[model samples]
Target: MADATVRPESRWYGPLAATPRHLFVPRWWSPGERDGTWVYELRDGASDPDAWMSCAYDKSLSVITRVGPHHADHAASAAVVPEAWPTSSATLPALVVKLYQHAFLADDSRLLVTCGSGYGTALACRRLGDGRVTSVDVDPYLIQSARDRLAAAGHRPQLEICDVTGALPGVYDRIVSTVSVQGIPASWLAALAPGGRMVTALSGTGLLIVADKTADGGATGQVAPEPAAFMGTRHGDDYPPAPDHADLWATARKADGESVTTGRYPVMRVNSTWDVRSTLELTVPGIEHRMESGADGTRTAYMLHPDGSWARATAPGARQVPTVHQGGPRRLWDELDRIRTWLVIDGDLPVAGAAVRIDPDGTCHLSRSGWSASIGAQ
Candidate 1:
C-alpha cells in the first residue's frame, strides 16, 4: 500500500511489506534540529513499529539512519538526538523508483547503486536478482546493515564500503547514483562499460542528468523527467567551510578598476532559478556570491572571483537601492545586466543546450546564445 504512491509499482512491494520499517530507520534526523530540541536521536524502535512505519512511508520525507556516522546500536531507548549533521539516510521511495526507471534497467543488465539506508538498493535487488546487483557506500556500518537486511529476506548482492566518488568495484552495464556529484568524475567514466548508461544528479541544482558513456572523454545525455536532491559524496566527516561573506564583500567594495552601475534589480537571491542565478553566473563568471544581514540593519551581497573580479551590492532594509562597486577587466554588473537583458528578450534559457566544452585541464565553458560563462575548481 505504501509503495503504490511512489511509482512504477514494484514487485518488491511484498518484500517491503514484509520487512519492518523500524529495523532500518531506528531513528530520524531533521534538517537542522526541531526547535532547540535535536531530533537526531534514535527513537527506540525495538518497542514501536507504528511510529517508525508512519515515518518510513511518508512520501516526501527522508529517514535518517546515521547522524554524523553515529550508528543506532549503542544508543539508549529514549536517547536525545545528536546535533551532528545527517550522514546516511533512507531516501523517499518516490525518488528511489524515479531514478531506477530513468536508468531503464534491462532484465539482463548488472546494476551498481549506492547503498545508504539500503532501502533503495533492496528495491533494485528485488527487481533484478542479487547476482545482477551491486551496492556500495563509504560507511562500513551501513554496508553491513544493508547486507544483513538484504540477506534476511533472501537476497545477496555485492555490498562494499568503497566511496562512490572513486573507482567502482567492477564494470557495470548501468550505474544509478542516488547521490549528487560535484562533477562526473573521470573514474566513473573509466569504470563504466562501453555503451552503458549512468544516471546522476548534479551537485548544485535539482536537475537529474541521464547520460550514456561514449568512446570519448565525455558523455552525451539529457536531464531526467523529474528533479532529485542527493547528498553529495564526502571524503571526510565534514566539508571545508564556505568562503566568508563579510570579508569578500569588504574586499570587492574596496577594489577600484572597472566601471560601476547604480541600480537595476533590487538585492536578489543568488540561488533563484528565474533569471538571477543565470545572470549572476554569466556576468560574474567564476565569482561567488555572499549575503549578510547585520544586527545594525544592513543587508549586503558580495561577489568574488579567483580572477580578482569582485562586486558588492548593499542596501538598507527592504526599501531603497544598493550601492555597487567592482574591479577587473570585466564590469561584473554589466555582465549581469546583459544576462537579464537576454532573459527579458527570450522567455527561458537552455541548460543542456548550454554549449558545454571541457578543456584538458578540466575547466568547463558554458556558452549559450552568444553569452559564455566559465566554471573551474577553486
Candidate 2:
C-alpha cells in the first residue's frame, strides 16, 4: 500500500500520482472466507476513510466492484454478501503496471485497454494522453461511470461498451487485457495493428501470454515467467451458476471410487502453487479444484470437471502420503501425479516460459522442452 521507494520514473508516474484510484471505486468489495462461507464485505470510503486509503493505495490488492450481479456501489453500507464471485474489479495496481510494462509501451503508442474500474485506463491516458487511449468494457454502466470519473480526474479518453472478444473499438499499437480468455480471440488478431503487441492471462490459469502480431494475422511469443490471475471475460450480467454437482460432491467428500491408491506425496492443494497448477490447467482446462482440512489434521482435496470427472484425495498430515479415489472418464488425480512426476524428473514444468503460437482461428499451441499442449477456442 505504501510503496514510495519503488519508482520507474516514466510517463506513468506523473499519471499515477495525479489519478486517485479511490475516485474510481468509492465503494468496493473485499472478500473473506468465514466459517467455510465465502463472503463479500462492502467497504465504503466515506464511512471508513482510513480503511479506504489503506486498500485504495495498496499496490497489490484488487477492489471488487461487482460480485455476481451485485455491485458494491449499490449495496448498503457495511453490507456483507455471502457466496458471491467477483465479476468486476479495479485490478491491483502493481499487476496493471506489470501488464503495461510487458506491453513495452512507447510514448507515442496508441493503447486499447479494457475498462473494469477504469483505473487502469486512466493510468494509460495519463501516460499516452487521452487522445491515444481507447477503453472498452462489456458493461455499459461501467463504461459510462468510468467516463465520468476520468473526466473528474481531469482527463477524457474514448470509452465504449463492447465485448472484448467480439470486436475491438479501434486498431491500436497495444492491446492490454485484464480479463482472461481461454484462447486469444480471432477478432483480436484482425484488429491489432501490425507490429502491435498484446498482454493477457489465459483463463483458468495464471499464464501471462505476451505475443506480438505476426505478418500472417497470427501471433507468436513466450509465456511470461510470473503468474497473474484475472476473471474471465463475461458477456452476460453474471456468469452462469456453477453446475450443481451434489452427487459428485458427496462422492468426493465421503465415498470411495472405482480405484484407490496410495499417493506418492502428501495431500497437495495443487491450485495454490502457480507453476504446477498452471501446467495442470494447460494440460486439462475447465477443472474446478477445492481443498479442505479436518480437525484431526486430515487434509482432503477434490477435482471436478464439467465432463463429470471427479477425484478425491486425503492425507493424514504433511508427511504421510494420501489415499486417492478417482472416477468418471478420467483419473484426475493420476493425471495430476503424472504432471508432478514430469516436473520432478525435469526439475521444472514446461508451462514456465513456454512458446505460445496462436493461430488465426484462436487455437493456441504451447510447447517447451519437447512437450506440447493446445487450447481450442472457448
Candidate 3:
C-alpha cells in the first residue's frame, strides 16, 4: 500500500509501510443486497488471512468498521445486518496521505487527528512520534479499541473519546480530519495554535479546505486542486434518520409538475459526477437524488428538496435529451441545467482552486473567477 500510495523518497512512505493496518482493523463490513434491501455482510480477518491482507493493503478501499449501530468486532460470525449509514472506517491509505499532504506537517508539528480505526493515527505516530500526536473519536469503543491495537503495534498516541465538532483536548500546530464536516467548527479555531494549519473536507461536497491560522484568529487558504470525500461526522452511535421524503417521492413519480419541457441536456446521474454534484450542492444545498432504469434502455431521475420542491426527468436512451418535470417554488431541474450549462461554457467549475477565508466563528467564504459562496456554521 505504501509503494502504491507514495514514493519511497516521501517522508510519509516509511510510516505507511511500517504501520500494521490489519492490526487496527481485524473485522469490517462489506455491502451487499438481500431481497432488494441493502445489507452489510461482516468480514473477519481471522476467518480468512489472504482476504485480510489484500483488503488491508488495498490503497484505495476504505475498510468499514461500524455500520449504523452494529460494530464489526462485536458482531456474530458471518452476520449480515441491514444497511444504514456507515459510522466509522479505516480510511483508504491513499486518501489518508492526501489529507496529510494537505496539512504540510513538519517534523516538530504537534498534530491532532480524527481517529476511527486508528490506522491513520498509527501512521502519524510513526512519522512524528507518539508524543506529538493526539487522536480523538466520538465513539468510546473505537477509542478504546484503537488504544489497545496501537499499543500492541508499539506506538501509544494519546487517544481521547470526544466529538470532533466540540472542544478539543489541547492546542496543536496541525489539525487534520478523516471525517467530513458541514462547516468549520468554532472550537477548532480556538484549539489551533498560532500559525497553525487545518485540513478537512466539507460534508456533501468534494471541496477540501486547507487554511493557515492568521494573526486575527481566522484562517486563509484555497481549495485543493484534487477532490476528495469522507463519511460525515456523527455525534452518536448513528446519525439521525434521514428526513422523511415518502410523499415527495410519490409526487415526483406520478404528479404532473408545475412546468414540463424538454431538458437542454441528457439525463444524468448527478450524484456520481463529483464536480457537477459539488457545485450543485454549493448552489442548492440539501437536495436528495434518486435514479431508476428500465429494461428497454429508458432511464429516469428524480431530485427532491426539503422545501417541497421536486424535479423528474426521463430519457429514452443514453445521450438523449430528457423530458423534464419540475414543481414547487423553485425549478430544481432548471437550476441543475443552468449549472451544467455553466460547466459547458467554462472549462471547469470555479469551486476547485477557489480562495477560502474562514472567520473566527467558523463561517467559510469561497470565491473564484468572480463567483462566490458562503457556508455558515451548521
Candidate 4:
C-alpha cells in the first residue's frame, strides 16, 4: 500500500485516507471479457505503489470485488480480471460516507446495513463500533467472504446470510441500504425500531429515499439531496430477462391503427441521468424504452411494457420530425408528451422529496410536483 491522496487532515478525508482501497479492490473487469468463462486477476502493484494510489483515489471507479453474486473466492481467480461489466464493487469511500451522513448515524445508533464487499460495513464499524453494525446479503458467498475479510482485519461486525430485500434479522435505530430496492420492503420497516430512519435508493433510478419508520406499519419520506447508485435487488444471481425482445418488437412497431406525433423534445439523452429516468419511469409506468441506430442513418427508440403499452419513434436526422406510434389505455407517448409539457412549463418535474406512502401490503405511492402514481406488486 502507498500513501493516499484522499486527505487525512480534512473532516471526511480521514476515512478516505485511512481506509486501504487497494485491499478492497485488488482486481476488476472490462467489456471484452463478456463471453469468457473465467475473469478476474490479482493486482501487481506491490512493485508500483503510485499506480495503485491513483486507482484507490479515483472517484469515478468502483473497486470490483464480486460479480454475478459470486464473490472473488468461488469466482475464477483470473476471472476477476478487467473484462465484463463489473457486477459488484466496494463503492468508492466518499460515496459511502455521504450515504452514512445521510443515514445520520450516531455513536449510540445500531445499524443494519447491506453487505457487498464489506468495505461499507468496515466504515460503519469504524464510525459506530463493530457491535453496532449488522450487515446482510442474499448470497452466502458474499456474507462469508465479507466475514473473513472483516475478521482478518480484527473487526467482528454482525454478518448474516440473508436476503436484504426481504426480512432483516436485527432491530436498529437506523437502516442504511447500499443496494437499490424495487420496493420499500415491509420487513425492513418491521425490523426498524420505532422512529428509526432508513436511507436507501430506489431501484432503476438515482433517487435516494430518506424516510422515518412510523408506528402504523408504514413509513413516510422525501428524497435526499445527494444521488447514489447501488446494485439493484436480486432474486437470483442475474435478473430474469426483462420482457422478451420479440414481444417488445411485436407490440412496439405495429403495422397499423395508431396515432403519430412529431415529438417536441428532439432526441434527449434519457438513458444516463437518474432524475430523467425516474420521471419517465413514473410517468410512463411499465413501458420500457429501447434505442437503436441503423447502419445507414435511421435511429429509433421504442417503449414497450406488459400492459400492452407501446411507443416508437424514428428519426432520420437530429432535430427532424420523429414518427411516433402508440397504443394502450394510457397512451405512453402522450405521457411522455405530458412530461415534456411539464418540463416546458415548470422546467422540471419534482423528483426528490416526492411524497412516498407505503401501505402494509408493500405498495408504494409516489406523488410530487402535482403528478401522483402508484406501483403495485412486481
Q: Which segments of model 1 are wrong by more than 4 Å?
A: 1-22, 32-51, 67-85, 240-246, 249-263, 272-341, 352-378
lDDT preference between candidates 1 and 3, better one: 3
C-alpha root-mean-square deviation, each candidate: 4.8, 1.5, 0.9, 3.9
Candidate 1 vs 3: which has more TM-score: 3
**Cα lDDT of model 1 by residue, 203-309, tens digit:** 65555667776667556566554656677777765455555556555667676546556646666556655245644543454567667786877777776776666
What ordering of candidates by lDDT runs from best to worst?
3, 2, 4, 1
Candidate numbers sorted by TM-score from highest down = 3, 2, 4, 1
Name the candidate that leads on TM-score: 3
| Best of the two (2, 4) by lDDT | 2
Query: Tens digit of lDDT per residue, candidate 3, span 199-318?
Result: 999999988889999999889999999888889999888899999999999999998898999999999999888788989999999999999999999999999999999999999998
User: Which 10 successive residues of model 1 have the least lDDT summed?
Assistant: 355-364
lDDT of 4 by residue, 91-208 (tens): 7666777778777877799899888788778778777788899998877767777787787655798899887777788888999988888778888778888888888887767788
Which segments of model 3 are wrong by more than 4 Å? none
lDDT of each: 0.67, 0.87, 0.93, 0.71
Regarding lDDT, does 3 or 4 come out ahead? 3
TM-score, candidate number 1 = 0.75
Separately for all candidates shown, the number of backbone clashes (residues 3 or more apart, or on different chains) is 1, 1, 0, 14
lDDT against true structure, model 2: 0.87
Better of 1 and 4 by lDDT: 4
- What C-alpha lDDT does candidate 4 achieve relative to the native structure? 0.71
